[model samples]
Target chain A: MEQILRYRVQNDFSALSRFLEELRGLPGYARLNERQAYRLGLVLEEMISNIIKYGYDDSKVHEIEVVIRWGDMKITVELSDDGHPFDPMRHHCPGSNSAEPLEQRPIGGLGIHLARQMSEEMTYRRENGRNILQIQIGGGVAGD
Target chain B: MEIGFEMKDKMTIVHLQGRLDAETSPAAESQLLPRLSASGGNWLVDLKDLEFISSAGLRVFLMLAKRARECGTKLTLCSLRPGVRNVFEISGFCTIFAIEDSPAGI
Candidate 1:
């Protein structure tokens, strides 16, 4: 069986926290093991935080739509925002070269990088002035 | 999130409890950054009770690590849960910060 959940989240930290708590309360969430739940939360937090921080240029409030499709072995999240046309897949991840000294490493893209690493698959697209990102988690294979 | 401090030897053990995500990261940064100084000795962040961490939380750790380096001090993390450890490793933070299984020795 599959379950679908949808939420309209405000572009703010408080809303994000509330949404995350609600997500944890879902019946499907109970099926996820500790590691899977943690990865899901991390991916959601990283992606939504980026949208709240950089997806907008104006100070106006916006609503981000999130859809979660919870399956028996996998969970998929679809996030749509009307803020900007940014693609997370193409975002440059700095500070990844471990060979570089710590002091010289820049800390700009670690968030997106972490999100990408935790999720099984991530795809981004722009449609009708909205940036839509879909991320899949579970299936037992994540950044081992 | 709640942060408590304990002094062991010359090291400062920071106990972090609760979730450290975007909602709490700003406060965590403000509260933790001012405590680091050149004269201060090493720091070991204890995340045993920390239920969750996101990129925002990671950013604060990165900043703290950078500041600790600038102040000529060492920063280590210990007692990371499996979930938390995965985040650190995936972000390559494991290479930057010294990690321990427990807070046994500084």
Candidate 2:
């Protein structure tokens, strides 16, 4: 059987924290190995934090929808935000010039890069004025 | 996240416990940034008990490293869990910061 978890969070850090807490209480979360779970959490945090910090233009409150499907040795997370249209897949990844000095290195792109690196697959698209990002990670279920 | 520190001779060891994400990163930065001395010194961050970290946390560490460089202070990170290690490696932080298995040698 598959376990699907859905969550709605505001465009704020505290909401993200609460959503993560709720996620950890689910049975599907217990099936994940330490590494898989960590990657999932990291990806969610990176994506949500990015949307909260940069996805919005006005001071109005917005809601982000998160859906997670777990089973079949895989876990997929989908995040939908009604903020501006931004594609994480097209975002730049920094640290390409590893030899560059620290002062010259830019810090803006590392979050998206790390999120992309942690997941097996990531896709982004704009639909109905909403930005939808889907991330999938394989081999999520742990063995006894 | 709980931040604690211990001074040992010329080296100061800082212990980080709990999650370091967007929610806690601002407080972590406020506490950690002020601890970096303008004078030269050695510092080690122990992450054995740190359960989680995201890009927000990584940004704080990067800022700390930059400040340490400007102050002529030595900064090191030690005892990272496997998950945290993966994050550092992916972000190329493993090359930028001095990381070790433990605080025994350095």
Task: List native contact recovery per candidate, as a fraction of 1.
Answer: 0.71, 0.62
In candidate 2, the residue pairs with backbone N, CA or C atoms under 3 Å apart (3 or more residues apart, or in different chains) clash, namely none
Question: lDDT tens digits, residues B80-101, model 2?
Answer: 9988898888887888999999
Per-residue lDDT over A2-70 for candidate 1, one digit per residue giving the tens place of the 0 to 100 score: 888899999988899899988888777878877788888888988998898898989888999999887
Model 1 chain A, poorest ten-residue lDDT window? A135-144
Top candidate by DockQ: 1
Model 1 chain B: lowest-lDDT 10 consecutive positions: B33-42
In model 1, what are the clashing residue pairs, if there are any?
Answer: none
Candidate 1: TM-score?
Answer: 0.91
Q: Give the per-residue lDDT of model 1 (tens digit) for B1-106.
A: 9999988888888999989888898999998998976338989999999989887788898889889988888898999998888888877788889999998855
How much DockQ does model 2 earn? 0.65
Best prediction by TM-score: 2
For each of the candidates, the C-alpha root-mean-square deviation to the true structure, in angstroms, is: 2.2, 2.2
TM-score of each: 0.91, 0.93
Candidate 1, residue B81: the lDDT equals: 92
